[model samples]
Structures are given as C-alpha cells and as structure tokens.
Target: MAIAKFAGGWAFNSKAMVADAWHSIADLASDILTLATVSVSLKPPSERFPLGFGKIESLGSLGVSSMLLIGGCYMGWESAITLYAHFDPESAHHILEHIGHGHSHSHSHSAADLGIPSLHAAWLAGGTILIKEWLYHATMKVARERKSSVLASNAVHHRVDSLTGIVTLAAILGANALESAAWLDPVGGLLISIMVINAGFGNTVASLYELVDQSIDKEVKSSIRKQAQKALANIRDGHEAEVRDVSGVKSGQNYLVDLELAVPGSWTIDGVKDLEDTVRTQLAAKVRGVRRVRVRFLSRDAPDDKKYAEFIPGSPGALPEEEGSSKQNDELVDGHSDKHKH
Candidate 1:
C-alpha cells in the first residue's frame, strides 16, 4: 500500500496521498516493533530479570509510538509550510527565495502545482482505506483476547491509517473535480498528521505508565484477590496462618502478585512451604497472567525468643542431658554467659 500510494501520489500531484503513504510507513514500523517483541517479550524469567521479559513488549510499543509522533510532527510541519504557500503563492515564493533548491522546491511544488489529482492516487488511497480498516479490526480483536498492550497500540495505529486514507481519498477526488480546490490536499495531509500525533502521544503515555509498574485495574485486582482468598479458604481453616494482604504489579501484559502471610511463630518450615506452594499454584491456575507469586511469612511470636533465652533454669536436670552437661560448666563458671544465650 505504501509503495503504491507513494508512486501514485507523486505522479498524480496529490500531497494528501503522499502524506497517507507516510502514515502507511509508520504502520510498517509498528509491525516491525510487534515482530521484534513477540519472541523476546515471551521469554521466561532470568536471574537478572526475575519478573520475566514482559516489559520488552512495552518498550517496543514505546518505540513504535515515538516514531509515529516524530513522523507526524515532521509531516505536519511540512504540510503547514505547503498550506502557507498554497494560500499566497507570491508571498511564499519570496519567503523561500533564499532557501536551497532541495528544501524550497519540495514545499513550493506541492503548494503551487496546478495539476489536478489523478484517479490513480484516488484508487490507491481508497484501497489503503480498506486494507488498514480490516487490519485494525483483526489486530484489535487479538489484542483484547491476549491483553497485549503493544498489539493494542499497533491496532490503534492501523485505525488512524485507515482514517487518514479516507481523508486522503476525499481530498484527492475533490481536488480532481474542483480546479480551485487544490488546497484540500494539504488540508487533508494536515488533518491526517494530527490524527497520527494523537494516536502516538496517547499510546506513548500509556506505555510509560506501564514502565513505571502501574497497578492493574481495580476490578481485575479485586477478581484476583477473590480467587486467591478462596484458594486460601481451605488451608486457613486448618492452619495457624492467615493471609495479611494481597498486592500486585502490572508488567506489560502480565501481573506479579505479592502475598503477605501472618503465620504463628510455631508454624513449621514444612507448613510455610505448603502455604507457599498452595498460594502460587492456585493463583497461577485461576488468575489470568499471574506470572509470579511471592509469599512472605511474618511470625507473631518469633520476636520473644530473646526474652525466653534470657532465663537460665535453676536446676541442671531441667535441661536436656547432653545440652545440660555441656552448658553446666559454662553456667557454673559464670552465673550468666552471653555466648550461651547468643
């Protein structure tokens, strides 16, 4: 679509078609980002990135949005200069007199060219409108199902491209039909630039939010919490441990959960291990995109060990035999031994 639009745009003297072609180029860049992120972002967690490589998809989407923003800005600037020239040819010619041939001609020609837009450019624009619109629908459907931010961003780009194609097609047909309405081409270009910029800026902001480890939606988090609470319901009744809190972090398309647990100081290591396994298994199985679950055990009575150790039994018989025999000499040598307590 881009190649055809570019050729037809220049050949038919349609500035709007050329701008739309560049929009198609931006779509290609977005596709590149999508392809690059697919494999890398799905990688399993590593020592350096214990939470996994999901953020790579967000970074790739950011790159796509940045390109669209810069490209749109540049295209808008160029279209603005052309519009200025088209409105007042004499003034624009004098204003760009000192500029180099390469720079001045590019803008002046698009603005001052008297040739009407051709049917070829109109056909190219119309064709791209259909293509981009279809791609937008298809990609957006997959994005929603997979909860993929990058795919969603790219899908938005495709929708913008389709909209720009519509504007380009109308402008081309209008310019061809009305001899004095040549300015419509640059106007269409300007409108498309704004649309592209809006899409880019919005997606860029969203990606940055993800990069900062933004929390997921309240409803989604609540759903996850409900499912987790149910998972713990069975064990909470039998054990001395209870769930203290459940928090989560959003990374790209996935979520990482932190499960804070309050366990009795007498809770054995085996019990804690069982709790960890149960929480992780249930959350990962029941919740969508639960990539990691970290459980923290807080002991209620463990802090009193120091106070208990301070007491020295009066009788050696009160202690375990081997322990009493070994520690008896130390206790006799000094009524208190810091080493023994420690």
Candidate 2:
C-alpha cells in the first residue's frame, strides 16, 4: 500500500513506473515464496518425499535469488539505455519542482522526463539501484538468522543492486554535470553488470563451501573439547580417560554430542557403564550448549609396574630372628656359647 501511494504521488516517467513496479513485484514474490518454502520444508513428509523438506526450502530461496538478480540486472540495463537517449533535463526539473512544491501540475511528461538532473535516465536507474540495495540487506539478515542458503544468495543480488546504484548515480551525475564525459553513463552500466556477475560468482562459491561439509573453526572445536573435558571430569576414571571423538548434531536450537572415551582395563564392565552414564549426565547438566550426550567406552591396558623395578625393589628390612633373640645375645656376650660347645 505504501509503495502504491509512493507510485501514485511521485512525478515519475511511465518507464520508471514500469521498472519500479517490476522490481517491487519481484521482491514481494520472492519474500512470499521464501516463507512458503520454509513452511513446506518444515512440514512432515510422506512416501513421495521421504526426507524432511528443509533443504528444499533453501533451494527455493536460491531460485528466488537467481530471479531477483536477473531482474535487477535487466532494470539496470534499461536505465542505462534511457540515459544514452539524452533525455531533456527541463522536463525532469519541472517534475522535481512539482514534487518539491507539493503541487499537482498538468504537464505532459514522458518516462524520459524522469532522467537525472543533468543526465538522461539517471533518476530512474539510481532510485531502482537504491531500493534494491535496501531489500538486499533486509533479506540477507533473515537468511543468516534462519541459516537459509537461498536467502543469502538473494541478499547477494541486493548487494549487486547497491553497486549498480553507485555506478548509475556516478554516471548520471558525471554526464549531467560534465557534458564532455557523457560516455560515462553506458560505461558505468557495464561496470554495474560486472559487479553483479562478481557477486553471483561469490554466492556460487559460498554454496559450494556449504555443500562440502567443511570443518568448523579451530577456536570453536577447542571450546567444545574443553567443555567435553569439563563434563567428563565427573566420571570415576574420567580424569585419566582419553577422549577420542566428539560428534555433534543440531536439534532445534540445541546440540547433541556423541563422545568416544578410552579408559583403563582395570575398570569393570559395571564401572565403565557407570562412568559412561556419569559423563553423559554431567555433560547434559553442566554444559551450557549441550542438549544431549552419548558416550561410547573402549578398554585400554594399564602400564606395567614391573618396568620400574629398580626404582621400587622388593626386600625385607627386619634382622634374622636367631641373632636378634635374647638367649643368643646372652650366650655371645657372657661366654655361654663356649659351655655349649664343650
């Protein structure tokens, strides 16, 4: 409704209106499609589409982004062409005066009249570029929060829109203000196309990165390891135990981690089970981001104590009983041993 009001009240040329209307419709349709895709993706699946359709939602967003990019590029091209036609500035000034003064004037103005203050078609092209940029950021934010690839891709289109706006604005301003450099308009349009292409390429690279299941950052992995270590400490032999693998799966806003632990062979089956349970329970209770934990136990042989025999020898510290006896002591000291020999 607001758009409609703007469209009606603005002193824009017919071509500008058509271009704006097209851009607006495409953006609206993309938004609606994204929402619908998300809903369908979240729906329970049947036999035909067995896998939960969340990924399809992303694909839908990608498709919408592609369309938006194409439309934006086309609009940019059209604006460039309008500038090349060398539209009259007097008509644009007249419309501007009418809009600024808030007066309805009955002057016949063609779409060509919506040109830049000095250049041909600058106003229409520049305005479209600006609008596209605004939409891009808005959509990107939504996509990032939802973790939707499609939305991110669409957002790239908006970035391209912004770049194009810069080119168009510069070109129009240059042509109008400096007649010597009138060729800048078309050159700027070409540059805008290149920028859009570059953005599209970037989106493709990002999508491929996501598809490859890339490893997370070292800092994040280290943090998770620290949390796991902290959680495992509650177990009996957990302090000595070695943690091998920790795999996590996202469930809604939370995460579930499966841990593999290596413990000593001395630990009984029941003891190992208890340790496993302790680790899982402790992690679930103590870890801030951990929603669930599954622990797997593996037995490890304890190091042999015999290897350090020199450091811990086996020997008796007590003297011989016969030598220590009182009778033996008296016989030796008082000549009692001689009487026994005789």
User: Best by TM-score, which number?
Assistant: 1
Best by lDDT: 1
Q: Which stretches of candidate 2 lie over 4 Å from their true place?
A: 1-34, 37-54, 64-164, 180-182, 212-220, 234-237, 246-259, 265-297, 300-342
* Alpha-carbon shift of residue 189 in model 1 (angstroms): 0.9
lDDT of each: 0.78, 0.55
Q: What does the lDDT come to for candidate 2?
A: 0.55
Error of 2 at 306 (Å): 31
Report the Cα lDDT for candidate 1: 0.78
**Candidate 1 ranges with C-alpha deviation above 4 Å:** 94-115, 140-156, 177-179, 234-244, 262-266, 298-342
lDDT by residue (112-226, candidate 2, tens digit) is 3434334334565666666777888788889888776557856865664455556556765675687455555545555655554454455444434433434334554565677
lDDT, candidate 2, at 234: 59
Question: What clash pairs does model 1 have?
Answer: none
